[model samples]
Structure formats: C-alpha cells, structure tokens
Target: MYDQLVNLISTLGFPIAVSIYSLVSLSTKLDELIKSVQEVKEDISAVIKYQKEK
Candidate 1:
C-alpha cells in the first residue's frame, strides 16, 4: 500500500507541474503575440493614411 501511494504521487506530480508551467508560458507568449499584432495594425493604418494623402 505504501509503495502504491508513493508511485501514484510520483506519477501524478510531474505531469501536473509541467502542464501548469506550460499553460503559464503559453499565456505569456500569447500576450506578446497580441501586442505585436496590435503594433502591426497601427503601422498598416498609418501607411494607408499616408498613401491617401499622397
């Protein structure tokens, strides 16, 4: 019983930790991607406005 309990804890712990870490990392990366996309949108709008003026 003790060995089974230990084996169960070990098996469950690492994957859960890795899954949580991956989610946090993905959230950070997604935020960066969103910011970059917003910047690109602004740049495109500026170019369009400039072309219209010319």
Candidate 2:
C-alpha cells in the first residue's frame, strides 16, 4: 500500500509540475506579445500624426 501510494504521488507530481511550467511560459509569451503589439500601435499613431502635421 505504501509503495503504491508513493508511486502514484510521483507519477502525478511530474505531470503537475510540467503543466504549471507550461502555463507560466505561455502567460509570459502572451504578455510579451501584447506589449509588442501596443508598441507598434503607438508607433503607427506617431507616424499618422507626423503626416498630418506635414
């Protein structure tokens, strides 16, 4: 019974750890993507304003 419990826990722990790591990585990538898109939007707005001034 003890060995079965240990085996069960070990098996579950690895997948759980991997899933958490994947989620964190995905979240970081999405945040970076959002920041990059926002930067591009701001740059475009500046160009449009500059053209209008000219």
Candidate 3:
C-alpha cells in the first residue's frame, strides 16, 4: 500500500508541476505579446503624424 501510494504521488506530481510551468510560461509570453502590440501602436501613430505633417 505504501509503495502504491508513493507511485501514485510521483505520477501526479510530474503532471502538476508541468501544468504550473506551462501556465507561467504562457503568462510570460502573453505579456511579451502585449508589449509588442503596444510598440506597434506607437509606430503606427508616429507614421500617421508624419503623414499629416506632409
């Protein structure tokens, strides 16, 4: 019974750890994407201003 419990815990722990890691990585990637989009918006605004000046 003790061995079985240990095996079960080991199996479950790996997937739980993987899930937590995946969520953290996904959150970081989403933050990067948002920052990139904000940069693009700024670039577009600059282009619009330049066109208006011309």
TM-score of each: 0.74, 0.66, 0.68
- Candidate order by TM-score, decreasing, is 1, 3, 2
lDDT of each: 0.85, 0.85, 0.85
Q: Write the per-residue lDDT of candidate 1 for residues 1-54, one digit (tens) a residue.
A: 668646755888867756866898999999999999999999999999999999
Error of 3 at 26 (Å): 0.8
Candidate 2 regions with alpha-carbon error over 4 angstroms: 1-13
Q: Which residue pairs overlap in candidate 3's backbone?
A: none
Where is the poorest 10-residue window by lDDT in model 2?
1-10
lDDT of 2 by residue, 1-54 (tens): 668646755878867756866898999999999999999999999999999999
Any runs in candidate 1 off by more than 4 Å, and if so which?
A: 1-12
lDDT comparing candidate 2 with the true structure: 0.85
Question: Which candidate achieves the best TM-score against the true structure?
Answer: 1
C-alpha RMSD values across all candidates: 7.0, 6.7, 6.9
Alpha carbon lDDT at 9, candidate 2: 58
